[model samples]
Target: MHRSVTAGAAAAALLALSACSSSGSSGSSGSSSPAASASASSAVTGTVTVFAAASLKNTFTQIGKMFEDAHPGTKVVFNFGGSDTLAASIVNGAPADVFASASLATMRTVTDKGDAAGTPTVFVGNGLEIAVQPGNPLHITELQGLANPSVKVVLCAKTVPCGAAAQTALAAGNVTVTPVSYEQDVTATLTEVGLGEADAGLVYQTDVKGAAGKVDGVNFPEAACAINKYPIVTLAHPSR
Candidate 1:
């Protein structure tokens, strides 16, 4: 998925102030001191809508909660999906303040359209892994193991970042796989294996870690060749 601050720092500050002013909340009661009231009146409050990659769901949820707590009345709403899909939505005029994509390529879609508030930045990196049923039932091992005819694999569609990374890793290992299905996103591909619908799937290492008991992660040396850099940018949209 992509990584960007919801808005530029100044814009975010302005948005927070706007939310505080609209709520018309006086932080202290009538008995409070004037200085205390002034302090309370300056509290930040507003809703920031963010478009993020599916893989960031868990981590970003935590971050959002912390931000809301720190800002008191501020709200952070997230729309998590494939970076490519989210970029398309933003370029097509979808309302989003921040975008965090899984790859620089997806981020470029928004940047190319002049939809970004500033230069995109790389915030995180992830590598691919093999997700399988909770045990070594298939005895699958590496990128080579996925090439087995009976593996019943699911891979992300080539257009998606994770799928593209998987392809790079496969090429590095000189292995081939004919997936039974091609999912539009890494989460969906992981879902197939988590639900026992497929024997194995190619997904991000973080995804396998997030799935916990639903799937087991198998790391291969070839994953080094396909590490994905996550990029984030603020969209050039009015603050909510």
Candidate 2:
């Protein structure tokens, strides 16, 4: 659904501050005091809409809630979907304030259009895994296992980051899979397996963790070949 990221340190504090202002200048923070907290809270008091990757749904939801709590009267709304789709939406004037993409290439779609407030920074990294039913009913093991003709695998569309990563991992392992279906996003791919619609699907580790009991994750060595770095940036729009 999305594409690239760089050093992780760049976005350490972006989560809390990106939605606060339009300034590109940096400032040092003082000791956390009541006055400082009050000043931060009063800096911004409107809704900040974030368009993010579906894989970020769980993590971003938590962050959004914390943001809302830290600044009373301020709201943080999120639109989570495949990174590629989100990027396309933003480029077409989706009216979002922030964009946290799972892929660097996906973020480039927006940045290249001059739609970003600043450089997009890597906030985190995610790797792929095989999501299957609660137990190993078919005894599927590694990337090679997905090659079985009867596996009934589901995959994300190659245009999306997760799907692209899955393809990389499969290539690294020299394994081939004929998916039963191609989903638009990783969430949809994982849901297919979670609902027992497919035997397995390649998805981000975070996705499996998010689905928990609904699906079980199978780690494979090839996943290291396609780890995706997540990037966060404030979109250049009328809101800021």
Candidate 3:
């Protein structure tokens, strides 16, 4: 996974999460001196509202809890949904301290509208997976398998990161698929397959992993062609 936090947006980034350590943290002298660390830690307070993509729900929730435990007076609130929807919300004057998107393209939407502060950092790289029922009743193996008319395939809408990646992977595989329904986010698509509402759904590997027991993941080679780079940024206006 590709991960990086922008130094310029360090404060807001830290507000969103402080449980993680930098790669150099193992060294004697890290980026920040002990004195600076103490001072910064003391100053971190209040609620920091973060707009994040749905795919980050599991990991981000764990990190948010860790951050709150580290800082007594601080709270990290998250609004998880489609990256495009979150970007649109930020650009439309939503009150958010940070924006964590599932795709660079979606993050660009916020940055282009001047809703982001400093520069956006690439936080992770995600690939696609086909989420199927635990027993694999359909016996699906690849992307093209979803092309069968009898398969109830669910896909993310073209506007969302997962959906866009699915489209790219499908095109790369030269497979034509008409999904039974288009969901708004990867989590939603995965939910459809997990609940047995759909035969299979195209979603992020992370989503499938998060729903491990409930759904089985089928990895396809074409996924490499549509890997999504997640981006995070501190919003310009953060309402407490």
Task: Give lDDT per model, in order.
Answer: 0.76, 0.77, 0.77
Q: Candidates sorted by lDDT, descending order?
A: 3, 2, 1
lDDT of 3 by residue, 1-240 (tens): 001222322354443342242221111111444654554565455677778899888878888887778767667788999999888888898888788888888989999889877677664578898999997899999888999999999999999999999999999999999988999888889989989999999988878878858999999999989988776767887754
RMSD of each: 10.2, 8.1, 6.2
Off by over 4 Å in 1: 1-43
Candidate 3 Cα RMSD (Å): 6.2
Please give the lDDT score at residue 153 for candidate 2.
99
lDDT of 1 by residue, 156-232 (tens): 99998998998999999999899999998988999999988999999988788788789998989999899888766
TM-score of 1: 0.83
Per-prediction TM-score: 0.83, 0.84, 0.86
How much is the lDDT of residue 95 in candidate 2?
Answer: 79
Model 2: CA > 4 A from native: 1-13, 17-42, 238-240
